[model samples]
Target: MAANSPEGATPRESRSWTLRLRRAIDQHLPMGHLLPDRQPYYVGSWVYVFGVITIAALAWVIVSGVVLSFMGPQWWHDSRLGRFVNSLHFWSVQLFFIFMVLHLWGQYFMAGWRHGRAATWMIGVVIFAVSILTAFTGYLTQQNFDAQFIAINAKDAMNSAGIGAFFNVLNFGQMYGLHVMLLPIGITFLVVAHIVMVRARGVVKPIDAEGARS
Candidate 1:
């Protein structure tokens, strides 16, 4: 007859969990959350690995970026090892974007954005936007003919968009540090945060009560 009771046994069972936690703490006993016995959480979707592959690609980008950073900007253009690392970094970026785009698309179709998972999806979209901006800035900092051309072409659009006032695209020095350091750090943190949220909430199952299997 409790006001909070919808189904008596179900509410009582839920409340019992809280009391057990309290007792465990009072008695200094180890307590853990009961994980669902759902098998739907890790359905054999290859798309599941797409997001992970993107993370792995980002890791490669970071490693190559670090090597290139120690060599400095000019060294990449002048030295064989530096140039090879730069190419590796460039390819890693391409791979990261490819995998992430696919992951996002797959999530959308799978309706992985359902439940309380909307926040996770929104945060991920923002991270994707940031990564794109980082990539553009990265391409601008190469200081090669391609970089010069892009800087010239992209300069006006940025100025028109008001971003040019805050950032000087022509400044390879600043862009270099931002690409290899600041933005990479930001992207890495975002990915880690996203993964934490995913693991904490667990994967959502589709409609038709299939989540019970999950």
Candidate 2:
């Protein structure tokens, strides 16, 4: 401990996990940065809004999906209330994908990978890919003819590729578990990670700054 340190304070090298975590939080996400009322002027572009819209849609999707899971597929197809909720979840998915694609394209052309932000860019890409798989699993859990047909058709290909045993889409229970339990958790994790990384690095500079950096 330094001479000026408090009596019980641990040295930096051997700090407790709790202290380390608090330090990391302060270092990476100071209060103003974490919930800023202002951002760089370049972020004013219309394209920047799509990323937040995509996240909003995802939040709605998850809320509606949780309700749908409790009610189950039969209720969704038969009950008016359930159908309304199902529509919310479905449309939210569509909006999520639409905004996500637009955001991805906008970010890519802006060279979002610049300024030591490669991991942030890669994580965004992974989130997009994983979100598609999550949506596919959602479709498979719908318990409709479309789901049955898709599962049956895809299972053959999955097996030929030697992965069907592990990811047996034909099994309604497996697909349901994945959609309701596993994949949602994964998407939630990736979303959290992407948001944290964004806050840690700050947004990428505008494309014009790219050439100037060179």
Candidate 3:
């Protein structure tokens, strides 16, 4: 049987699709690059920490938001524990934005789009934009007077943009659905893509260093 079969060929090697996929992944995102133990010397700078901090804040946001989702709005407003969790979610979001902005500006100043990493920069921008929309929908789903005021104003803005027919800010169900589901998923996916691209291309070299080298 061994002689009849191709010599030195394992069962896994016989699967062409799997082999092709493995080869493609290795070529594009090798394990060493994806999860490196070491990085460029410049990566030791404090600015590089901002991106990790932003991701940490986002983790807290997601955890607290999950709890709030399960308990609902009324519980969050009335119950002590729910209120605490709500505060956690709110503060986490604040921190997430703060660190994300810091990271974004840090990268911008460093010309993060350099070294063929434009896609990484663009994905980060998209994540920021999507996060703003997610936060807006979250505010509209608050089910309070403040929410009402925001919805009313936002309705006018959407109407002015000629998208009110499709995206009614006054609709609680729609806003809540987007806040808890769609927008979060979009942001998460974009963030993952951004990280992957960063790993694939490696961090951009310092502008001064590149200039000196050139």
**Top lDDT: which candidate number?**
3
Q: Which 10-residue span in candidate 2 carries the lowest summed lDDT?
A: 1-10
| Deviation from native of the Cα of residue 113 in model 2, angstroms | 1.3
Error of 2 at 114 (Å): 0.8
Query: Would you estimate the TM-scores of all the predictions?
Result: 0.79, 0.89, 0.88
Ranking by lDDT: 3, 2, 1
Clashing pairs in 1: 38-214, 40-214
Residues 150-172, model 3: lDDT tens digits:
99988988999898999999999
Global lDDT of each candidate: 0.78, 0.84, 0.86
* Global Cα lDDT for candidate 3: 0.86
Single out the weakest 10-residue window by summed lDDT for candidate 3.
1-10
Residue 111 CA displacement from its true place in model 2, Å: 0.9
Residue 195 miss distance in model 1 (angstroms): 0.6
The sequence of per-residue lDDT tens digits that candidate 1 reaches over residues 1-214 is: 0123323244455467666455444333222212335546556789788988999998898899888878877898988888899999999999999999999998988888777778789879989999998999889988889999998888899899998887878878777778877888888888877875576567777655544434
Badly placed stretches (over 4 Å) of model 3 are 1-17, 208-214
Candidate 1 — which residues are off by over 4 angstroms?
1-42, 210-214
